[model samples]
Target: MRTNGDLNNTSAAREVARIDIDAAHSYRSLAISEAEDDATIRKSYRPFLLSPEITSTDWISKLELSTVVKLAEEDLHKTGERLKVLVLYGSLRERSYSRLLAFEASRILFRLGCDVRVFDPTGLPMKDDVQHNQPKVQELRDLGRLERRPCLGLCRATWESHCRLQKPNRLDPPLRRLRRPTQGRTLAIAQVSGGSQSFNAVNSLRLLGRWMRMFVIPNQSSVPMAYTQFTDERLADPVEGGSRMIPSGNRMRIVDCMEEFVKYTILMRPHFALFGDRCSEREERVEKERKATEKARKEAEEKRVE
Candidate 1:
C-alpha cells in the first residue's frame, strides 16, 4: 500500500507511524526516535516537498481524474438563484436624453424585482494607458469581475459615444473583462434615440452589444425629437414649443415596451446561487479520502516491515 514516492524511502515507515499514532505517549516517543534517527530523511521529505513531475500515462490519467473531481466540486458549489444587472450609459450630456432613458429603464427593472446598478461614463477615462490605473477605472474593472451574477450595460447612441467607431484591435480593459460570458449572467443592450435618428443609434448599440457577446434585445426605443419629449421635471411631457405633444398612444407604447424589456431581463436567465451544502460535502469527501488513503498505505508499510 506504500505510495510510489514513499516506496523507495525506508524512513517513510517511521514517518507514517508518527502520523497514524493516536496515543499521545506513543506518538511522542516515535516522533522523537524518528527525529533523532532520521534527520536527513525528514529533510528529504520536508513539508514543502515539490510534487514529482507527472509523466506516466497512469499519472496523467490520475491528473485528469483529479481535474474532473475539482471541476465537479466547483459545479456542485455553484448555485443558480439570484441575478445582478449592471447598466452602462454612453452619454454624458448635461441634459442627456440617454441618461434619462437609462434612469427610466432602471426604475422599470427595479419595480420588476431585479437588482440594478448604473455606471456613469462621465469620469471614465478614454481607453488609454494613462487612465488605466486610475481608481475609478479600477472600480469599473472590479465591477466587471463580479463572479456571482452577470452584469448588463445600457448605452445610448450619440455622436460622442455610440456612433463613434472603435479602433481595430484596441479594446478598453473594462469592456474586455465585462464581455466574458458566465454561467448565469447575461448582457442586454438598448438604444435611446433623440428622434428618427434613434433608428441609427439602435443599430449602433446592437453592433456594440454584439461585439461584446451580450444578448442584444431587439426591443429598442427611439424618442423622435427627444428633446421636446421630456419636461423640466424629466418626465415624458412629450410636448414642445407649447404646441405639439407626443400622442398618448405613442407614450403608452414606449411605457409598455419598457415594461416588457424589464420582464424579459429577469426571466431571461437563471441566476447562480451559492451552494454551501455541496461545497461542504465535497470538502469532507476530499479530506476523508486523503486520510483513508494515507492510513491504508501506512498500515500496509508497517506490516511489511514487521
Candidate 2:
C-alpha cells in the first residue's frame, strides 16, 4: 500500500544506520588491539628502560619490583657519598686562554681528591628555538643530570671586551643555565687580560657571577699579557733565571684556591648523594653475600648425592 517515495526513504535510512553500526564496531576493535600492543611493548621494555644497565651478572632472572626496590633502599643506607663538580669555560677562541686556566683548575681538583669534569662551549648553539638535539647540548644536559656537582664557569675578560661592540651581554642566561652551579659549589672567575686592562675584565666577570646567584670567590686572578706567559708546552715560562714567571705564581695561587674549593665540594657531595640513597659499596656487599649463600647450598647438595 506504500508509495515508491516512501519505500526509497526507508531504504536510505536503513543503509545509513548500517554504516554507522559498522564504523563503531571497527573503531572499537582497533582500539582494543592498540591497547594490547601497548601493554606488550611496556612489559617487554620496562626493565631496560628503568635501570638501563645490568650492573651485576648474579641477579635473579625473575626479580619482583618490590625486591628491587628493597635492595635499592638497602644500598642507600650503607655508604656516605659526595657531590660532583662540573667546570665550564665561556670562550670559543682558538687557543683560548680561559680554557687553559680551566685545565689548570682541573689539575688542582684532581690533586685534591674530588671528581671533576669540564665542558667546552665551542659549537654550542646560542640558546634558541632550533638547537635542541645538538650533541654538545645533549652532553651538557647529561652532565647536568648525572654529575650532581656544583658548576664552575670560567671566561676571559679580553674576549668579552672584543665582543662587547658586537653583543654587549652575550653569555648570560644560556651559560648560566648550562652551568647550574649551586650555591654550595664554588665559582672562581679567572680573567685573562692584556696589560693593565685586567681590572675591567675582573669587574665584568664579578657582575655576571652575581647575577647568576653563584658563590663567587672575590679572590680572582687577572693574567696580564697572557700570550707571552705560557711556553709551547703550556707551562708557565720563567721570567728570570732564578725565579718563576709572574704567571707561574698566579697558577700556584689558583691551585691553592682550588684546594679549598675541592674541600667544600667534598663536604657538599654526601648530602647530594644522600637524597637518592644510591650506594655502590652496599650493592657489592649484598652481591657477595648472595654468592656465598648459593655456593654453600650447592656444596651441601653435592654432599647429599655422595
| Model 1 regions lying over 4 Å from their true place | 1-82, 148-173, 181-185, 234-254, 271-306
* Candidate 2, position 302, lDDT: 100
Give the runs in model 2 whose Cα sits over 4 Å from its true position: 1-83, 145-172, 178-184, 234-247, 266-306
C-alpha-based local distance difference test score of model 1: 0.45
Q: Estimate, for each residue in 50-136, the C-alpha lDDT of model 2 and write its tens digit.
A: 121221111211112232222222332443322245666667776766666665555444323233456656567666757667777
TM-score of each: 0.49, 0.49
Scored by CA lDDT, what does every candidate get? 0.45, 0.47
Put down candidate 1 lDDT per residue, 167-255, tens digits, no spaces.
21122456665664422234444444443543655565566566665555556665556666544643422222111223444344444
**What local lDDT does model 1 show for residue 148?**
42
